[model samples]
Target: SSSFFGDYPDVVAFILIVIVGIFVAMGSKASTNFNSMFTIVNMAVIVIVVGYGITFADFSLWTGTDAEGRSNFFPYGVNGMLAGAASCFFAYIGFDGLATAGEEAKS
Candidate 1:
């Protein structure tokens, strides 16, 4: 199951989300505005979580590499950088949700 989570993004991931949404919708979920609140809260949570992550991290860990340092986390040269950037591409989606949130509230 864990492998399925990352193996087939289209079939496994989309189907799981659709199944969950169906269940939630059947459960009499809140008005559309409720989703706006959730969206804003989710954005805030992402910001806070990312912000807080800085505290527990060792800045040196992303820097040096040796038997003692944790810096080798991205030893794969440009590939590591590419992977990190690609993974974070989705972080840019918050603004779109914000637009939907504003529209949902205005109505």
Candidate 2:
């Protein structure tokens, strides 16, 4: 938003607050409809992007063999893969808590 709308954090915050207030005032039905519409649009965008990206993807890159005839599939080896898994686990660890946090909310 800052990139597209310039560096006006206060204005952006005000607009966001107004949008949230509108959604809240409109009640659950309107909010749910908007959420569903946004989800469909988001999925469409993802599909379009992935479809476009497939055109430029090089399947040979997965083999980790460069033009110089050197095979480096696992450059960092098993330790690197383990480290990456751990890093990703830590990054996404909070999401599960967020998903369950709403369970206790008044519906």
Candidate 3:
């Protein structure tokens, strides 16, 4: 069946599994080096994207009124912001379980 990645979901899955298996077969040092390289590339991309966004961002929009004369900042009001913050907090709350697991680890 076709998937979001395109038609050939099985082929994509097989390719990904093979790649992951290759990484697993490699020594830990090789895996760590590849992971570090990818992390650096990811951080560079993020920095570039953020820098480009900041260059064109209009800060006035944050405090100014919208075309409909509503407050631009907190367009949905403080309650909406609070609700969004709570949702995000709950979404990431699972990460705390990792800390608990770490505490229980032998090392």
Best lDDT among the predictions, by candidate number: 3
TM-score of 2: 0.59
What 10-residue stretch in candidate 2 is worst by lDDT? 98-107
lDDT leaderboard ranking: 3, 2, 1
* Per-model TM-score on C-alpha atoms: 0.38, 0.59, 0.56
Model 1 lDDT at residue 10:
73
Q: Count of backbone clashes for each model?
A: 0, 0, 0
Badly placed stretches (over 4 Å) of model 3 are 1-13, 65-71, 86-107
Whose lDDT is higher: candidate 1's or candidate 2's?
Answer: 2
Residues 1-107, candidate 2, lDDT per residue (tens digit)?
24666554688789988997797578767766877888899999999999999999877766866666656566666888999999999999997896596455444
> Candidate 1 at residue 20, lDDT?
57
RMSD of each: 8.9, 5.5, 4.8
Candidate 1 wrong stretches, greater than 4 Å: 1-32, 67-73, 83-107
- Which is the leading candidate under TM-score? 2
Alpha-carbon shift of residue 87 in model 3 (angstroms): 4.8
Which model, 1 or 3, shows the larger lDDT?
3
lDDT of 1 at 98: 71
Ranking 2 against 3 by lDDT, winner:
3
